[model samples]
Structures are given as structure tokens and as C-alpha cells.
Target: MLSESSRPIIESTLQTIAERINDITVIFYRKMFEYHPELMDGMFSRADQAEGIQPRALAGSVPVFASYILANPDSYPDEMLARIAHKHASLGVTADQYEIVYKYLFAAIAENLGDACTPEIAEAWTEVYWLMADVLVKIEKGLYDGQKNDVIHSNFKLVSRKEAGTSVLDMIFEPADSTVMSDAVAGQYVTVIVKTEDGLRQPRQYTLLPSAQNQRRIAVKQNEDGEVSPMLHKLEVGDIIEISNPYGDVVLGGYSDQDSQPLYLFSAGIGIVPMVAFLAELKKNHSKRSVVAVHADSSSEAWPLREEYLKLVAELDDAKAISFLKDGEGDFQGEVRVESLDMPRLASVYMCGPLSYMQSVRSALVQQGIPGRNIQYEIFGPDQWILRATRRSMRGNRV
Candidate 1:
């Protein structure tokens, strides 16, 4: 535990470290592509990287992590951790890869900070990185250990594939061996690993759609631009996919145990996956908690789980669905446009989807004076926001 006397200094040191990390992340990617040409294969989106979004997001995340540690240690922002873990887990990033990232990160820091990179500062930052890496390594190990001990990886066999709707697939994974499939919380996800022709394994995640509890299944919306998604879409029945045990933090347990509070779930496109899962669990448990589900897509056709969401809504008196787009058609109902949504009675607002959509929703919520604690979000990739937010808070305190 960090002592009260050491808290301020540690916080200050962490702030500096966050600044340095922002520098390191930018340079690390440049060096990675230069030295590790093979790693670019399926590991990064070239177009997105070229657009400078993912890189900038990663650079910003270091500071957000520092902020979370100093400002909100109790919760530790599960949303941020879940997002990064999902991305890393999807790629099957190992403890070894974390070390690689740390190496490149520190090296770039030393290079960028130059005269400012005093030995003392470098050591302090390295200690912080190691501490963080150790924690992440342990968490990741727990996931791996669960898969190994429970043999969740061996249980799933692809039984069939059907076109749920344009590019979306309903994949059934039946137990091949006697391994009992672990019952997953509806909104949790599983890491699906596919062995490529080059013998390198690439992993992706899909939202486990609600189906018969006895059989494990998932709904995957294939991304043509994505390497893993396209390959996943191509798999035929009887094919095998290596899946890790279900893992995710975006769940609905908070309301189930407590008195019913007005819960609002906001999702866009594929972000609806976890929400669907949560609704399923709530229905199965027969919890009468009030939930308002609002989903937005580019069009009605792009919405991933339209039928299932409707079915769940029909069964539950407290559940409702609000669609923002219909087959490329834009908003019409005008009942709190995705950009305009802000409700005070909402006990918890869980958001998932693209960065822009999440950002827009977050901004609108903030404008409505919704406390950060009341807003939970799930992002799509590595966390740079966590570090950035922390640094901003630190700067405010200093001022």
C-alpha cells in the first residue's frame, strides 16, 4: 500500500512518468515497424495507424492510467482495463509481449527525454512500469490458468455457421470432450484463436449471443478490413476454434443485488454484444430490474443482434430498445438523439462501441453533469485515455 506521506511524491512521479510514456509510445511504434516487420501482419490496422488515431489513443492512455491510480484506485476503472485486455487478449498477447513493449517503451523514453532522463527519474518510471506489468501479467495468467485447468479451450467445436444478416454469423461451439462448458454471464466475451496458414495464431473476440444455456455460441459481425474477422467468417461447420474462458467486466450485477434503479445501456454497432449478453442473464435470473437499452447503427442492417434484442425486450417488462439508424437511414424519432441523450434518473449508464460514438456520448453526459462514477464505458482497443485523464487531474491540483 502507498503510504499517505509518500502519496503526493508518488503521484508527482507518476505524472512525470505518464508524460514520458506518451513520448515513448509514439516512438516505440515507429521502431517496432522498422525492426519487427513481420509483427505488422494482423497485429495493427495500417489504415487506422496511418490516420494516426490508434497511435494517438495509445499515447494518451499512459496518462489516463496514472490518473486512475492517483485519483480513483478503489474502482481502478474496470472499463478501461477491460478494453485494453480485450484488445490484447484478442491478439493472444503473452507475458513475453508485455516485456517487449516495456523494453521498447523505456528505450524510447531514454531517447526522447535525453537530458531530462536522469537516472533517478528513469528508475522511478521503470519501477512504475514493472509494477503495472506485474499486475497485468498476473491478471492475464489467471485467464490462461482458467483455460488450462477448466479445459475451456478444448470444449468448443464449431458445429455450424449461418448468415444471421449481412456479414454477421451465428457460430455454435459444441463441447467435443467431456469438459463442461462454463456458463458465461451474458455480456462477457471469449477470445477466439485461429491458426493461420503461416502457423502463427491470431485471436479475436465476439459477443456470446444468447442461445440455449447448454450450448455455447457467439455472434460475430465480420469486418472485411479486419484480418481475424474475415477469417472467422470463412470457417465452416466442424471446424475448431480455440477459445479462452469467458472474460469481461461489463456486467449487470450491480443492479441485480440492490433495489431496482433505472439503468440505461447505450451501445453502437457491435457494442451491443455485451449488452445483449447482460440482458440474457437478467432474463434467465428473472431479475425485474428496469433497463432501457438504446442501440445505434449506421443502418438497421448493420445492427448485430436486432432479432434477439427484440425478443429479450418482448419478454421483459422493464427492457426497451431504441434504434438510431435504419438501413443507412438516419435519426427520425428525435427522442433524445444519440448526441442529445441525457437523463438524470439513470442510476448507471453503460456505453460501448466506436471511439467517436463513445466520446460523443461521454461529452453529452458530462454536459448534463453526470458524475464520472455514474458513467461506465467499454472501449475497443488499448487504453491511452486513462493516462491522459489522470494527468489532467494532476495538472489541475498543481494549479
Candidate 2:
């Protein structure tokens, strides 16, 4: 909770701070990187920074956190904090790094606000920053403590690679060292670090694909212009790479209390990775729960892991698979039309895809009488969806 004196000060300055957040974040990154260039080599993505995605995400989150606290002073945003902590833990973020971020972030705020950044205003915003940071640090510590080992990363040797779809490579790997591997739940992800030709190591997170107990598998969607994916596509079977332990909160079978509730798994393009893992887990358990697996792609041939997806659904006792293809044979001829389907009551839903696609599906589901709390989603990159939703809710509540 914010101190009594700081609370009023934050309420007074939050609007001004929100208005200038984008500029503040832009300056913060520029100054931080200029002073500590080594952070760019592995800890941060140069591409996201250059494209301004990282800055915008930060700009969105701070104000949202402040606004939510003012509106509900008794509670913190646990869901948002948990999502962030999981990502931070996977990237090996430490408690000391928050102090470094605080220094640059506030300096940038002061620079952007100029004469308006009074001592009281600065102190209040500082309180907000640490309040959020402290919760994240605690959650990250818990995540680290639950791991099988204390190390941030482990070595994995590529065992085999094969084409799964149009531009996707399904690579399998085994532990290259004696490091203990934690059992990963369905719908979790791991960060893969690759050393580029420029002698710089870069990290990118990928969802763990379903595989045997002794092996780790991931499907890489080759981005010709991407710095990490293209390099990952060229690796040989004997090559070794660094991989982090799996960490994510969007696990299958965790949302609902009833084990018999119907489950809906929705995806688009490469977003099918996590959904496939969920289906495999259900099949392994021989679950009797009703299941609906839906996917959308440009064409039938463009879908990654299509055969495996269909086979898993078929092997289940009460599951069905549906596909919507724009240019090839499928159950539907165009994009997903959620209203056309007969959704079961009390169903739990999980969606992974582009932001626009998931947003549309979620809105349609809500309109069809599905409770908003029943649906959960995973974003492939820096989270922009939560920020958008928070802003929307705040706006609606304003007079």
C-alpha cells in the first residue's frame, strides 16, 4: 500500500505522468543503453528496442498499475504481476537489477517532466515503482525456488530437426550436461539463447512442444529477417545451445475447479504450439472431458503440426478438431466465427495468437454468454493486450 502522504500526491500527478510516459520510456531506454551497452548483448532484444515495442509496453504498464491501485486500494494486480514475474524469472532477472532500472527510469521521468517534476511528485511515483517492483521480486523468487537447479540456464544438444509445416522446424534436444531438468507443465515456454554470427548472444522465448520425458522440443518459425530464428534454423543435430527452465502461468487444467468442464483450445498460425501440448497432455491422461480444438491459417498446408494436432484430438474419447483456412480445404472457408459454433456451458477457454485475433474471439465469446473469467490468453511477445484492456476499463469507469 502507498503511504498516506504519497497516495494523494500520486493521484494528483498520475495524469501528467501518464501523458508523458511514452517520452519518458523512450529516453529511459536510450540513456540506460548508452551507459550499459552490455545489457543489449543478451538480456534485452535489440530488435524490440529499435522498433519501439519495448518502450510502448513499459509506458502502458506503469500508468495501468497506478490507476488500478487508486481504484482498488485494498488489492494488487496479481494476474498482471504473475505474468510479468514468470517472464522475468525465465530471463534470469535478479532483484538488484530493479534498482538499476529505477535509477534510469526516474531520471528519464525527471528529464521529461522538467520543471513540473517536483520533489513530492517524484517521491510518490517512486513509491509506485517500488510497490510494483517489490511484488515482482517476491514472485520471481518463488519461481526460482521451485526450479530443479539454481542455474539460470542449461546446455541442450540438438538430437534431430525436421520440417513440421511451411516454414516451421521441429527440433528435438537432450540435456548436454548433468543439470537437473524440471518437469514442464503444458502451455509453458523456455527461452533459447543463440550465438549469432556477429559474436553476440541473443535470447528468444519459444513454447515447449509436446515430447518425451527425456527430451525438450520446440518449433521454430523461421523469420528470414529475424536475428535469432534464422540462426536457430541453421543448427546441426550435434550443436549445443543454452535453454532456460520452462516458466509460465497459463497451464492447462488450472483455471477451473471442475475436472469435467469442457475445454476449448483456439489458435492461429504458429500459435498452435501451446495448444498442441495441451491436447497431448489430455490424451496422455485419457481425460474424459469434452474438448474443442480450433485453428486458423492462410491455408491447410500452412498450418504447423496439423497432423499431430488432428491425431491427438482423434485419440481422445470426446474431442473434435476444427480448422478455418482462407485458401484451402477446411471445415470453414474463412476466419474463425465463434458465434457459429455450439459452445457448451461452463467451458474453460484458452487462446493463443495475434492480438487482434484473440481480442476478436474473446469479444465474441463474451457476447455469446461466456463469462470473461473463463477465458485466458497468452501473448507471444511483450504484453500489449493487458495494457489495452486496463486502459479500456479505466476509461469506462471514469466520469
Which candidate comes out best when scored by lDDT? 2
- The candidate 1 region of ten consecutive residues with least summed lDDT is 330-339
Q: What would the per-residue lDDT of candidate 1 be over residues 74-176, giving only the tens digit for each residue?
A: 4454555556665555455578877767677778878887887777666655655665666666666666565534453453678877866568887888766
TM-score for each prediction?
0.79, 0.96
TM-score leader: 2
Clashing pairs in 2: none
Q: How far out, in Å, is residue 314 in model 2?
A: 0.6
- The lDDT of each candidate is 0.66, 0.87
After superposing candidate 2 on the true structure, give the runs of residues whose Cα lies further than 4 Å from its correct spot: 255-260, 393-399
TM-score of candidate 2 versus the correct structure, residues matched by position = 0.96
Model 1, C-alpha of 98: deviation from truth (Å) = 4.4
Worst 10 residues of 2 by lDDT: 390-399
